[model samples]
Target: MPDLSIQLLPGLKLKNPVIAASGTAGYGDEPNRLCDIADLGAFVCKGTTLKPRAGNPQPRIMETPYGLLNAIGLQNPGVEAVIEKYAPLWAGWTTPIFVNIAAESVDEYAKLAHRLDKVPGIAALEVNISCPNVAAGCLEFGSTPESAAAVTRAVKNATSLPVIVKLTPNTSDIVALAQAVESAGADAVSLINTLRGMAIDIKKRKPVLGNITGGLSGSAVKPVALAMVYRVAGAVKVPVIGCGGITTGEDAIEFLMAGATAVEVGTAALVNPRAPIEIVKSIENYMLEWKLTEMSQLIGAARR
Candidate 1:
């Protein structure tokens, strides 16, 4: 059988390459009830902030043809609450947990990372600088290379934990963003965090999402994600984690071939709670059928 394990960073090693992405996986708790949480390489919890946020108003989510749009506004019970409530129990779980964090300012990002630095059971910090739903400290930092590098440098300096900067597809040049983060000390990068999109209620003649514009994610985004992974992976020396529309083993494999060291499951898990687990099993089956003995053989093959 193939060894699906991948070392995403110097100290952050995962048993497999399939991880439960932030937002959909819910603090590493809900999936444990729905499927074998152990099947996941790691769980990137929802966007944790400095203070609890009420999130956007009603109509925060709207389902599209093969996609789901959301402006959840990085809603969570704040960083301190997450540490006090979930860290202790997560400490016992074998699967690694990464707290996804979103902040309103560069200083806030560093502060959140510093706080999480002391929290046990937190395998790493997934810095979310690309949340389009928020009014501030969101896409602005991620859209520009200088600002993105600044945030990465800030978070990296604040935490002892491995920092994985999440990349936004809304940028003009994703490779530049990836390279900037890498230079600024990101341990790894996860790409394609929902493209900016909107939906209209023809009957009401108004926007369907309360926030006006939301992040678009699901099977519909797989192609765009694949392209970014291919481009950014080629540009950066650090590990790249492909995320966006991955739902099946083949999709995961496609990303690996495109040079992604790992994959994150998001909207797919929302549609089917067991999608992450199923993806893991399916990947193993694919390796068995193909007689592939290691994941390294798949990763970056397309680029070669």
Candidate 2:
């Protein structure tokens, strides 16, 4: 088979371009019992906050056609718990584990990153800027270029680990935001965090999600996600990690062609814990069938 290895970041490399999205994958240890954790390019742990959060009220998830809506509210144990609980476990695994961190303010992000700096097994840091369901200033940081850059800059200063800023799809110009983060010292950028969407229940006569609104992700958002990846890839110099509704190898190929150095599987993982491993196999088979030499050759292959 063709070499599937792709460099996700300048210094950070992966055996393949398939990674599990944060929040959906839980800790890297969750799926280790079901499949080989080493098979994935990387697994991002659930979003960790400054402190443990109960998350949004019940009915936090609702199924939609070919997609799902989630208002997870970044529920996670505090950063200390993450380092104490999962970091050691991850250190023993061969697959790189990127820690996804979320905070209400730039200062919070900085403090969290600083704490994680000394933790072992954390290969990288993914700043979660697109959390729409939080009541505090979570979404605000991602809604504007200045705030986005501010968070990126703060986190960059706090840690030497490779920083990948996760961008929210709720913004007006995602490309502009991507450029801003790149300029702010992001080693890479991941996009299409989640589309701000809502579901309504006629029988219940109210919103389906307890938060009234949630982030939409799944196969339904694939096209929008691919388009944004394509646009952002062209606009920024940093590598783009494409996410949002990716399920199959074909979907992954689409993102790779659009210029994503790697692809992240989210909701699919919830339905099947082995989804990312299957995706890695599927991509490998597809690469062989197409006689591709390296995964990087597929980047930006799609033309308008």
Candidate 3:
């Protein structure tokens, strides 16, 4: 195993640095047939809301050159349904399962967090503040420092479980937002949520995605994600979970060097459900090749 475990949050320890990102991994059960979910450091469930969302219309996804565009609209069965359906299954698993929640208002986020506070299967609550592909205030709460802090404070007050604020890349100053969340009592922070982008069909004179615009994610955004992670990691005292277009062990290493305590695989996992397992193996191999003892030693190694 090479002892790849790392401390992701103050009281949370992960077996490896590779975690499955929210929205990409469906409740840790969908990919079980394709890969071993227990091998992952953790699995972040799909974005849950206070109520069920049908999501955007059809053609919600479009493939770019080296990335993907999506407007899933946080389509989920709400918190109660999530607990009833997957909490029991997660309780039996060895790997930790973090529930990712999204909301239009701070009150909605607080209510959802309070509901999940006592759920035995959940290990943490990832507050998603950067969902740009939807209307009705998805990105409104995350784009500004004030709203971000307020949401963080509300969630922290409602739950004893660790709260990780998921940040968006569309902000003018991500470091400021990260610092604000930390000040507001976030246990940790994760970034960079998908970059806001849209694809247009010139030939058809229509947008490629059903929702005119969508968030872009994949290998193409790795460099931008790394820069944001580097800046945010230095700004916030809490741990940062890097996520964007990480697809390989090398990509994961880049994130670790940029100061991420752990890395989350999103778009890559869609291509290969076993990508996280491979990432874990690759990280171990890299550590062995470099004679490194712990993954923590690699964090912020690129800073120097």
Q: Per-residue lDDT tens digits of candidate 1, residues 94-176?
A: 99999999988999999999999968889999999898898988788999999999999999999899999999999889999
| Candidate 3: C-alpha lDDT | 0.91
Give the higher-lDDT candidate: 2 or 3.
Answer: 3
Write the number of the candidate with greater TM-score, choosing between 2 and 3.
3
lDDT of 3 at 173: 93
Compared with the true structure, what per-residue lDDT tens digits does model 2 show for residues 200-304? Answer: 899989999999999899988889999999999999988899998888888898999888999999988878877888888888888788888887678778854
Q: What lDDT would each prediction earn against the true structure?
A: 0.91, 0.88, 0.91
What is candidate 3's lDDT per residue for 144-178, written digit by digit as tens? 99999999999999999999999999989999999
| Model 2 error, position 155 (Å) | 0.4
| Sort order, TM-score high to low | 1, 3, 2
Any idea how many clashes model 3 has? 0
| Prediction RMSDs, each to the true structure | 1.0, 1.3, 1.0
